[model samples]
Target: MDALIATVKDNDLVVAFALVGLVMGVAILISKFLTRGKFQASAIAIILGLVLAYVGGVATGGEDGLADISLFSGIGLMGGGMLINLAIVATGFGASFDEMKKSGLGGIIALVLGVVLSFVIGAVIAWFFGYRDPIDLTTIGAGTATYIVGPVTGAALGAGSGVIALSVGAGLVKSVLTMVVTPFVAKYIGLNNPRSAIVFGGLLGTTSGVTAGLAATDKRLVPYGAMTSTFYTGLGLLMAPSVLFFAVKALVG
Candidate 1:
């Protein structure tokens, strides 16, 4: 356990980034091929990530015994896993692609608003907690916020606490919040069109793709959902680190 923790501490950034890229690549490929293009890249990435983590743990002979894999870890590995599920469900039952195309601008506006809303919500919560220190709150808030908006927010929160616990916690919190809020917000704001469904479906498909592989299921719907989720998850991952960087800057400034 100690040795594994040391290794992780020593190579945290490298390992995390490598895992992120590798997982995203693998998930995308798997969904593209195995699911006959029904799945998403993000889903394949997550499953591959879990496999890598488990393999790494085994190779290192870590005494933690898969302690690296948890709900929080899942969030890091499969950022929008749950949201993919929601997106998939919404797509399955909501608007069609034609409708989405007609409301293209509206959809874009809604997505932007959703992300902004998430950030505001996160900042408000952090402030309410009396978290006055920019450095500390930025880290915590970023971690917590990423789930809502993606890694950008999570990274922001991660600055304060370098510990995996804080990072994973923030990620998990963000994921849960996004899963619960994004869809409702989108619907309420009238972004529930076919284009939105297709977008959401793709995201869900990505998550579903990897989930299907992990669960040993070969259903097309699984991949469909996974792919849908993967798209958004990847977007989140790309944005998370940057958001964290800027978050710190805002606090300092």
Candidate 2:
């Protein structure tokens, strides 16, 4: 009982858990109102809930306090949250890809290839400039690739687990890069319609989700992505460091 109290007090797990529950409830309410029983929002709500949990958990120092937790266990929780969120969003918006048919697959493939190529190119440049840490270079490369190619490509390169620090660092870098490049790519691709914008936002969110899942030592990306707004770039920036801090702490502890 004393240990339980200490855990609660040190980590603020209660508050974090409560916040997550609240966010999930809100998501359900929103989905019900918007979809009117035709579409389920549970996946989206779950995602959002996890995001809230992570943000709240970090704010309360759960990562530092939960030092006893295994890296894989934490990552599992995080990744589960992210997958739930993705499933929800994908169910709602992935239909757009079907509409585009040939173009959709082509676009996804192109984006992936672009990201990989860009990372290779960026790594060479970083090396030429005398960057020593391969992990750091990889992070920089992944971020640059994501900006030039898209989220899929960026995530593929960024998800390397070579070093926990570099992987987390890459996540932050990718978020910044996504913010800078998403708008441009959307505009260039003629994604000006409101529907297109919504889908694009979901795609970007998914990219973040996948990267966080693969890179996070604790696997908390699912929850983080779910709680985050699909359209808000600032939210991504705010959450990236929180995720990274927790991840690094988990590694250190």
Candidate 3:
């Protein structure tokens, strides 16, 4: 038993991947049977992962969640930025530029509106919560566009770690909300075809959430939505520090 445990620990990253696959499989099964696919498998898997992370944190009283456990330590590396970026790149490779061009002016409008609206909403929420500093507000606002944007903006602006953490949390909530709401609103929002999916992706701007949501709505639309959402993320990253931050600073500082 001791020898087996040591071997598992040594192959921690591989084990982490296996565990994630297992979770996704279970979540897919649940989506197919229990929810009839109304609740997306990705969303369910995300919820399950969060639950596991919470449980791991509670059990070990550690900040790294499941990674704090010696056996699951590889999860920290597996879920790190390198792998996440790789996944994004891989997804981008599947998208067609011609399809993106079809979205045209509508896509551009969606992207601009999405960033501005999300940032305002996030900044307002931060202000209501007593976060008066422009830097903190900008960081959290950037997070509303996407989790990746939040940290990037926060780091560039020299915001505190706590503010950066809050930004990430806000972005996660938006992602989950997007995943849960997309399917239900798909019909009303005209999210049926590729052009609309591209626009929808820009409007939401969270790659995982947009991709998973579109997957639940229509698997064919996933790539289209993901492509625009990727662009939206880049736009948010670019604007958050220079444009958005400056506007906030001018207003509050």
Candidate 3: minimum summed lDDT over ten consecutive residues — where?
A: 85-94
Over the full model, what C-alpha lDDT does candidate 1 score relative to the true structure? Answer: 0.45
RMSD (Cα, Å) for all candidates, in order, is 12.6, 13.1, 3.3
Q: lDDT score of model 2?
A: 0.42
State candidate 3's TM-score: 0.78
Which ten contiguous residues of candidate 1 have the minimum total lDDT?
214-223
Error of 2 at 112 (Å): 3.6
lDDT of 3 by residue, 100-129 (tens): 787878888998899988999999999999
- Compare the candidates by lDDT and give the number of the best one: 3
Model 2: runs farther than 4 Å from truth? 1-86, 89-97, 132-164, 176-189, 193-206, 209-253
What are the lDDT scores of the predictions, listed in order? Answer: 0.45, 0.42, 0.86
In model 2, what is the error at residue 71, expressed in angstroms? 18
Cα lDDT tens digits, model 2, 166-233, are 43445456554453344334446555443333334344443553333322211222322222223233
In terms of TM-score, which candidate is strongest? Answer: 3
In model 2, how many backbone clashes occur?
A: 14
Candidate 1 lDDT over 123-162, as tens digits, reads 4566677756554444454344343333344444544334
